[model samples]
Target: MALQISSDCISCGACEPECPNTAIYSGGTEFEYFGKKFEALASDIFYIVPEKCTECIGFHEESQCAAVCPVDACIPDPEFPEDRSQLLAKKVHLHGS
Candidate 1:
């Protein structure tokens, strides 16, 4: 499943560098995906892009960003509960052959 950032985020920016897919970004920062850009959630907190997130399947044993987050701000996104296969598929789609 795609992981999400909760409001508990402290805007520490700790999870940003740990992300493999570059899915995590500073809040209020603009990010591009599928040829479209969206505004971030908060001007102070960090955020994650679900479409670009693959739960670190192809890159790590676990979500590195979540692992390194200090306050456990990163958590499973119930809105995007994907299984292992689905995550792997998303990884492939993001990187391509």
Candidate 2:
């Protein structure tokens, strides 16, 4: 599954830039991917775009958002469960391997 920023997020803006896929976004801010702009899902905390997130599979050993998050708000999304191969494929689709 993709990673998600829980309500525990402190809105520190620490995890936004560390994402290889640019999937992380500040609360209430816009996010772009594949030349398209996506609406913000959360207005009070940092948020992750599940369709754009690959758990840092192809680019890193672990989720960068989780790694840099000071409050441990980044965690797997149970609603979007996926395996390693699917995550890797998503990375390739987003970044063009």
Candidate 3:
């Protein structure tokens, strides 16, 4: 499943650099994907782009953002419940590996 950042986020910017897929972003900061930059989803707290989030499935045993989050704001997105194979495929799509 793709992980999500909850409202509990402290906006400390810790999880932003920890994501292997660069899915996490500071609130209100524009993010890029496929070479195109766009506005972020949230403007008050850190957020994760679900399209770019693989939960670190291809690179780690667990979500790096969740592991390093001090406030435990990063949690599974029940709206996008995906299994290992799906997550791996998404990772391959993002990294082109």
Candidate 4:
């Protein structure tokens, strides 16, 4: 499954750069994927794009955003219930195999 940022996020920007898939975006800012732009998921805090997220499966042993988050605001995104294999496939889809 993808990960989501909670209300506890401090807007410290710690998790932004840590995301291997670049799925984490700042509040109220636009995020682009494959030349397509999307609205911000959270207007007041950092949010992760479920479609672009892979929980760091292809780049790290653990979720780097969660690892570096000072407030532990990053948590599993229950809305998208994907397993390891699905996550890996998404990683490949985003960054190539």
lDDT of candidate 2 over 1-97, digit per residue (tens) = 9999999999999998899888888889988877878789899998999999999997889888999888899999999899999998998899889
- Give the residue spans of candidate 4 off by over 4 A: none
Give candidate 1's whole-model lDDT: 0.86
Q: For candidate 4, lDDT tens digit of each residue in 20-93?
A: 88899999999999989988888999899999999899789999999999899999989999999999899888
- TM-scores for all predictions: 0.90, 0.95, 0.96, 0.96
Model 4 lDDT at residue 34: 90
Clashes (backbone N, CA, C under 3 Å), per candidate, total: 0, 1, 0, 0
lDDT of each: 0.86, 0.90, 0.91, 0.91
Deviation from native of the Cα of residue 52 in model 4, angstroms? 1.0
lDDT of 1 at 22: 85
* Between candidates 2 and 3, the lDDT winner: 3
Considering summed lDDT, which 10 consecutive residues are worst modelled in model 3? 55-64
Segments in model 1 whose C-alpha atoms lie over 4 Å from true places: none
lDDT of 3 by residue, 1-97 (tens): 8889999999888899999999988888998998999998899999999989998987988889989899999999999999889989999999899
